[model samples]
Target: MCLRGKQRAGRVQSRVHVDTVDPLSAVSDGVYRLDREWRFTYVNAAAAALLARRVEDMVGQRALDCFPEVAGTVIEAEYRAVFADGRDRVFTYFHAPQGRWFEIRAFADPDGLTAFIRDVDDHHRSDQRRADRVAQLTAVLEALPQATVLLDGDGRIVSANRRWTETGEVIRDAGLRPGVIGDSYLEVLSQHLTAEDRRIIGAGIGGLVTGGPRAADPPFVHDYAHAMGSQRAYFRLQAARVEPSGQVVVTHTDITERVRDQQALAWRAAHDDLTELPNRARLLELVGEALGRDPGRGALLLLGLDGFKAVNDSLGHEVGDELLRQVGARLREQVRPCDVVGRLGGDQFLVLARGCDAAEAAALAFRLRTALTRPFCAEGIPVPLTASIGVAAAQPGGDGVHQLLSDADTAAAAAKGAGRDQVHVFSPGLREAARWRLEVANRLRDGAVDELVVHYQPLVRVDTGEPEGVEALLRWQHPERGLLSPAAFLSVAEETGQLIPITRWLLGETTRQAAEWAAGGLPLRMSVNISARHFSAETLVHDVRVALHDSGLAPENLVLELTETSVAEDPTRAEDQLSLLQNSGVVVAIDDFGTGWSSLAQLLALPIGTLKIDRSLLTAAARLAAGGSGSVLTAIVSLARTIGIRSVAEGVETPAHLQMVREAGCELAQGYLLARPMPAADVPRWASRVRAAGGDSCALALRGRAH
Candidate 1:
């Protein structure tokens, strides 16, 4: 018994040393020695600090004295429990004097009871802080934007965020009440509780509950949506299995607004702002869709304006703007209710029809063509317009919309080639041709970087058929595509505005070559065709002067050929440009005459010095299909005579045609009958033929000579 008592005493001493020597003791409670009477006791630094008194004075005082207010009840309980119950007691006591809280433990013994007290203030305060932080975090989770769901062990939802409940109300007319969380996941998303999403979410609860899809596990997120018509709402949902815990906590984030904005952005990107029409991108998409469907049931048409530039240039853009609006109206009228009419960028439009065969599509295109040809009155000006439409019927095959649109585009180009206001169907070959055109166009833009050259066709005097001048015609010596005629690529040049540079080159080169000839005492004239685009170019006048100065060729010896359409394109502007050239001493000759609307009156009004009759009309002169057909020639010839303009008969092939043309009082002739368009080196020899043909003395006057 004595040995055990000594061991207990040593253990007590060690615990006492540990408590007092510990540096945290100053911040802790104290150990106290109590008397048998429970009246006065010893105090430690922490105990004195808690009681708001000195330890020396505190000792010998009753435990209740230091904490009089709380001691009456709290302190007395610890004392009574240890003494009356004959048991150790432990309780929390708040001392008003220091306004601090502590835990007091008392033990009973023969001498009295020793007690250990711990302040426990910081610990309690720290616990309260942690609780506050958790509460704050909970509040934030409640306020998050995504709809969330919590589930119990049975796969029944247990809770949800406010966004979830609110979105439910928007999705349905009634609110998804708070109890909705306890519902099955499938029931919440779909009318059926066994939906796939429910199965997925349930399985997700099954595996790594807080991060993946498995049974009894919660995924990090549950992102899902239900569609209403064309609109769909999305949410991020999270659930945790917390297995034996049996409760799953879910969170939500709503992404409907973002989805809506993305959709709107996509739609706006492919739509035209002005007409709200499907733009090029959307049109291409439509073509794709059409092609993807049964080919025999769908068709597409690509329509492009023919000579619309003339109207836009002459009447101004405001009127042109109105014209476009009217065109849109007409197109809308022309298409069926189910058909789509989209503007595929400037002056290019596309039409798509379902259940229409190739022939019907062609008819539709022709209808549009007819309507467009009808004159329009905008800003008091009669504007005539037409469109070349390319028709492509869907073939039963695997093809993309972009490819089908390209085929349509190729067909449209072919239509334009056939003659404006016409329609052409697509063939497999057209795709390759279109590709070839792209390559050719690129080369043409580089100024024949791949071999663009010009050959001159001689114009001679009538009667004597003397050499008058030569017309410079561009020929593409494409490296791989082989030699190509102007008809094959000139339209591309004009369309891309490459004609300006090409015309400038032709003028300068022809001038230089002609000047060299003159230096060689040839003294021959040279004529270069000027596209309407070139005439409108700002540098046109400068180009003419530069050519003359660079080539040292006399301005009068250089004639500019203006096509009838180009001259009539903007007659006022045409006359203005002609006046500029004439004032610069450059002669102007109207080319491809009589076909355009500008009559003899209009032709005479322009400041032109020469007129080249159309080869078609001259071919008619050669045929003499009848007597009156011959009369038409006499009238045109007499008109040129009366206007005092020099007339050149084009396409004078046969001797009979040449004799007929000379008999018709034609002033000059240019065709194979004299010599075909030839190279510069061949011209000297050809000039020898002209001299032998007596072209030098063929006097040309707009008089009644032989008609």
Candidate 2:
């Protein structure tokens, strides 16, 4: 037993009398006693071991002098307090010199103080590590750019970083800056989100809480968009449940730019750069989608602009580009809200109208045509434009997008052929015609002139029935169609811009034939037709010169006949070309005079050598053949005479027509009455027969006049 000074005498007397065991010596904990004089009177084995001393060494030692390491520490202060106040206290302190922690309990009696101490370094180090971990985690959370929030199990916001608070302000309701700490996140969601969105967010958040089977384990993520005031943002939310504590760590990332970039890419892929309209690829895709959803519930109109190339060639491509943009806008105005207008490249556009039948489509096409026909003012120039529309109804039979577009294109070509500014619907006959045209266009482009043949028809002097010259006519000997006239493919040649080459071939072949006729003593002048396109050809004069030189044929023996409208279209250029040809001794005649819109002044200005009266005048004269009122014919003949040019009356099929033309003083007459257009080999025989007959059956009547 340990005692204070007051009990020292009694204890010493008792100790001197009785032999009692010391109970403090048998305890496991460090136990020690201090007297009121600050001296240790008792020391147990555990206490001496903790102090790294023997029990005998510590006994009877002053407490402060025994353990100098405890001086001025919480352990010493608590020990002194216990001694002074007769109380009990427990405290822990770290001993820096020994790198250890001491947990001590001091109990004081009336006379002295008793102390129990143990080493607690492990617990102290563990607490220090925990504090360091908390500091590191806080630093990481504060440094993150993404909005980060930590929530408790009850969905209460435990903590939020600056980024989280700032992002919240951006998306928060006006005038609401509620404190994030201790606020219920679930309540915020319920207040601000729509019903559907709230449900979704609630589900995601709920899955992060409670640690239930349905709760997501970790890395739960989702996307949501929000609009606050004028600001719109898209956020990607990611959450994870903290282990052991059941806390949730949620992060929100602003992905607005990514979303917008994706949308922009999609839009650019589906539109045309020049016209700002849906391009061919996108149009087909949309049409395919519509067909997939509702088969045959739409009609497609394929429109081709007429005279677009002229505008491009005359005004320049920049103006043409502006014109296309304006045309797209105009087409948009003409269509219904649900209809689609798209560019199919280069003067072609397509319209998709849902639930429109053939009749409705036709009406709509006409309206669109009218819309396009209105002059487009571009670059301060007004360009008159027209469109040929091909309408194709979506039949219940289920047409493919490609097939629909192809058929619509076919109909559009037919519209262009039937005369532009017209609308044509797709029909079996139209498809057949389009197929034939496609064949002709392909052949023309490939320069397939093998089927072409030149035939000659004799032009006879009206007074003698003697052949004056032979007009060379183009004939197409189709393997299947036998013989086709110029009407079969002349327009196609003109459209394909192949007429220049065809005309060159005609000039060369006729010159050669005239040379052959001259060699055979037939000596007939060769009249070959020329298309209007030849006048514009820069190489026309060179080609004619080469043909005459190569064939050794006299230029005076060749007459080039063209429609009057050809020259009237561009009088200045036409006059220049005619002067060049006439200066070269090549006769220039208006092939179908009196049938064109050429004025008398224009005709007088032309360097023409002959005026070939069209067959229409002959029909008119035949109607008045009985009265012999050849006034119109006489006026045409007089015009030719006044202009110092020969007059040829064409299409005379009977004696009355011939006699009428003769009375009208026409110098030359040619038609089936003289001879049908024959092969070059047959022309010589026919001219020979006319020369041998001395008088043709009609010539007999002219014999009296000759007499």
Candidate 3:
């Protein structure tokens, strides 16, 4: 390492002025300061913290008093050497009280001397791992034909391989020396370097030179030439920035050949083996990144081939692949480079556009829609496919990756919701709703006991309409704003892993309530909605059983509701767990049916006795009945009947809604049209209303619906 032209003669040796500030104070790597009397003058935060003593208490404390055993031996010699040399010294020592080994950082100071100690007992393997990684990097760098060198911030050569030396290059500076005492990198550079190189190196000399703030995500690359190597070599510098030290340690690798390898690897990783465009992984990564960051008033659109499934089903995947390629090319050409274009596995694709005013995002979406609409002749057939695009945008600091993707997904569902070949941009109301949802998520993570509460909505038989079960719904009675529904908190619950404890709490309380109900002759079934994140663990089931057992209730009385996506993530585990519950006499229901990824085939195969038609569909069915069109209601009713699984409509809010259920042929309608979730103490009284006229049941349902 060397620096060339700088004069050191007149430069004040500030490094020697330790003053009242202990030398250890400047050394973060575990340092200690000793006085003239061989007593401790200072200890760095690291050393003080490690020794479990305050810096104030350690200062002026005699060595023997601090550690009686180190009186005249290794510790004494260690302190003396630092004072004598006036330079840094390293040594290893066993610290019995700490029960560990240490690598000490020692140097002389104005007061006397200072030392930094690090507990390296557990670092042997870590050091080896680092060494092995460095060796691997060296091998990789050496194989490249391009010259490479890693330059320290001081403009000294930190690492230079054979390729770097072979290239004709060097830096000359003012003063020069080899193994010179008190010499610095400036000494070497001053001896040999060009004028231009000197200016480039000296650009930051008068300013505080530190790496910029840490990048949230890493694997960033910096491209430049190694001053030691005159050849135009593209070196990729990977830096690990340690904020506390204000230092960025960079590893240089010759990337001329490696870039080709990188492209090859990227192609392999992000392209389909059969049809190479962008794989699901690449699409998700790009989309996830786009979605994750503050897109700054940008829009995200998820475009799916409207009739892709039909294409694959009718024609072979080969024809489908060709069709996909043509479609991909058109989509690629449809957007500007500023927008991210990616294929999200199968026929799913996404576009992320920044600075694209809403109108522009809409315009781009239309172009993509038109490009996709073109008919492609495949497998002796003209296969026509359109797209359903869902668009969502960030509002100020409103959107992160999760929310954007979700909104896009929801918007896409809206496009699909409104027939395909259309694009749907998320409405302001939806974004506001999402914002509220995020608020709930934050509350869930912070252990917001204030807002947390559980409400139970009663479930009844279809014909008898008797309250047979109670579905627990979580409500956040926010202080600033009134009560909020699970829709606000559920997504947050799923995201922050609060769902587990929340589910556990819900299960435990439901068990207690159910036991009380049974004891009081109500004996209603206790049902709880399950989140996808929770099913991965056996703990939830164990918790349910514990709650049941603790509450003196039978496991047979518990009913767990799972939406399609929840089961899809881990169907085998779900099946096994649901079997455990069902075999114990409990019931399992697939909630929010007709709204998720799974099909009727999976639905029938699943171990469930009930299916809750999504509220949108049920509401649509009910609306049709209210409008005197019995046709749609009748058909939905027929579908439910044909499936053999009991159909439950979740948002029945009126008498007409209930009547529609009876007319449509669905079994149960739970809503504000039914009894709302009530306190456990009020349940027995409410349960008495089975024969208490439909209005009583209706009142409770409205309360739940209101929530």
| TM-score for all models, in order of appearance | 0.69, 0.73, 0.45
Q: RMSD of candidate 1 to the true fold? A: 11.1
What lDDT score belongs to each candidate, Candidate 1 first? 0.73, 0.81, 0.68
Best by lDDT: 2
lDDT, candidate 3, 244-332, per-residue tens: 32323334466666666776997899877655666666765765665456445678788888767767876888899988777777787
**lDDT at 231 for candidate 2?**
62
Candidate 1: tens digits of C-alpha lDDT, residues 392-458: 8877763757777788889998998887888898888998888877876887766573377889888
After superposing candidate 1, which stretches have Cα over 4 Å from the reference? 1-150, 155-196, 206-218, 226-234, 240-246, 277-297, 305-341, 363-386, 446-450, 480-483, 621-631, 689-707
Clashes of each: 27, 0, 37
**Candidate no. 3 TM-score:** 0.45
* Candidate of highest TM-score: 2
Candidate number with the higher lDDT (1 or 3): 1
lDDT digits (tens) for residues 71-121 of candidate 2: 898876787787667788988878776778878888878768878888888
Q: What are the C-alpha RMSDs, in order, of all predicted structures? A: 11.1, 7.3, 27.8
